[model samples]
Target: MAAAGPGSAEGTTGQSALAAHLAFRSAIGDVSGSTRRLSGELSRLEASTPGIAGRASGLFVRYVDHGVLQLRWMDAELAAATQLANAASEVKDPDMQLALLRRAGPRLQAAMMGSLLLAVWLDFLHLTDVALKQHIYSVEWLFVDLDRVQKMLKPAMTALSSGESGQVEAVARDIPALVGHLTREFAATREAMRAGAEKLQKILVLKESIEAITLLSALKFSLPSLPPSAPALLGMSLTVGGDGVMMGTRLVVSAEWVEMMRHLVRAGVLSLPTVSAAVRIQAGQVMMAQSHDELPKGVCDALGDGPEVQGMHVTGRAGAGMNEPPRHHILPKEFREWFEKRGFTGEMDIDQFCVKMEQANHEAIHGGGNWKLGRTWPGEWNRMILEALQKAETRTGRMLTRNEILDIVAERMEEYYIPLKFIPWRGP
Candidate 1:
């Protein structure tokens, strides 16, 4: 979950921290293990960007925040990577394990750090316009370095196999050290990334940190004086020693997803803002005040229907959700830049666009407001899109050209930009 996707424009530091962890994870493994603690994370998201399924800050921040779960996810991934690396070290074929270790480990370390840095930059909400490019470059370097080292290991392995086990042992001694060397290089990248991020975070005056317990500070828990602070929204499970004092460690514990849900409900009480959250405090007093249950309507609306992941698309296709790849195109500029500038030029796949449009409409048409488990977050998200488009349409205060709006939105989605729902800039 790249922080730039959609939703959180604020892109909390929590998001940055998580992205750092996720960056590490992508090289290591899947994000689901960290998802084990979603209940608490979801509650935090709701508190920060309520009704995101309805009206979100922006796509970038939304994804950034959604990525906080990735930090915890890193706990599991770090554990797995460390274990695998350790096992590879112990193998009788030290040469074989060393090869695997060198090939995959360094790149994983490098790319993950790069991601973490990007997340930090995003959370600060600087020129994502810049980060868009920087992120790709930094991560690209990660893979480049990784592939280089992995490729080197092949020849090294070939040489070792021609010798005795003592030679293999000699090479094995260097395995961890070589991997550590890569790790050191990754750390340097991480530092450079941090500098870039520090530069980025400097650009914005962010809102107060929203916590699951504090919800939103504006939406106070009580009628009058709201709690002054957004206490740390405790992780659903207080602790899990996933990494076990090696590689790196962080708290990640497993709990029933349902239990996690209950944690959100309780934490929700604390999360209420001084104003609107105050309304919920009164319970029945403020029907206008959106309640926890009321949170569902907009959420249901957003998760309407679509594939969860999507790929990059240089060529514009209006309805493509993420998982799909960018249609083949060789433009002078990247699709992201063209998109940020409110321009789209090059060959687009119209047939695929029509199919995606039909699919999106069908989901909106048939699925109506059906939400699966843990998907409450997406409903308001879709509403954010629908409403933003509707709002953008209304704001122009004229009979706008349909083709124009569609073109802008199609570009926005293509670049994986943020919560503008649709595009904010109306082309001339």
Candidate 2:
């Protein structure tokens, strides 16, 4: 039943990797597949940056690190996109599926956004490298680049945070143009540096100090005249595979909705970080909406009057829960089987499991203590809750409260960027 999503093994049949790649490209409307190409380029750049050293190398290093983080965030968002796709796939309602995909639009847009910053960073680094090589490094130029980058960063962040897919997509689409401009400039500079280095070779003299300043070993400037240990720099190295590979391998999502379903099979393979609790919570809400009307009487009986769906939002809507018939707590056999499948083989009956979960949740929220899952593995708790919901849906033919699902999943929300673990600027 759940095999309908993009990543499901059932869909892997006779389709070639190239065909699958094309299918995915079209489903998300990314015709150029620019983001994936950029990701591969960034991977190459990341490998080449470490040995570079000059007056502004520290800043360049930070840029590389920041690029990596952005990619990591993109990877996290990809997982979320997959989940959104999968949830949409599992349901029978077209309207609901569209709603889920619409919600997914912003995240998909955000996933391709890392390259924008990477491009800006590359431009700044190239300029700085040129200044250092030409012995014209200036402090004012540093701040100018910083200002320009920061200005661009704000809008990019806004796009990332926004749910407006069209807006985000526009921002992402503009990246390739900037990449083209910077790439041409980069090629010109590299050539000039190479020619200049060849001229200097005749009169070259190795010296420890350029003037009054004693050159430190760590501050060696990468000269353009020298053969690159690696191939080309970031901009010039963006060339993808051979012509045939590029032609046969072009990603194109079909116009048909059936093709879209084929691309969603592998959704939700990536694990979300603690900071993505909101996404998880939101997903839970969406899932609940799907099963709400179809919930079985027996499953309702199991949860009792106050089912206490974890992560469920508290609303003041009049007669929300009050109008419903009194709920009774009873563990059904199907619920037991579901837990067993998840490796919850202890003697704790269904009622005991519910009580423990509710009690742990109560203590965390109301006990004025450090809020944690109070379990050895918080992930286990989350898995149980989602699994239980799935079981309930199967037994009762209805979705449960997704907000409450968040209550369980939201047990541990972490910051997306931890200051202490970030760039060297954060300090050890």
Predictions in order: lDDT: 0.30, 0.36
How far out, in Å, is residue 228 in model 2?
A: 32
> How well does candidate 1 match the true structure in TM-score terms?
0.20
Off by over 4 Å in 2: 1-50, 53-56, 116-154, 169-188, 191-195, 201-428
Model 1 spans with C-alpha error above 4 angstroms: 1-43, 50-62, 65-83, 93-97, 125-428
Top-scoring candidate (TM-score) = 2
The residue-by-residue lDDT of candidate 1 on 1-428, one tens digit each, is 55443345424423433333333333344323323334344444444433222232334444434345334434443454455444333333322233223322322332233232223222222222223323322434443543454454443343333222223323332332233333344334444554655566722221122122123211122222212242332111112223211111321112232122222112211011111111222121122222222322211122121221011111122221224322211111223343334323221212112211233433442244353431344433333344455566688885434334443444434343221111111112
What's the C-alpha lDDT at position 46 in model 2? 51
Best by lDDT: 2
Q: Write down the worst ten-residue block by lDDT for model 2.
A: 418-427
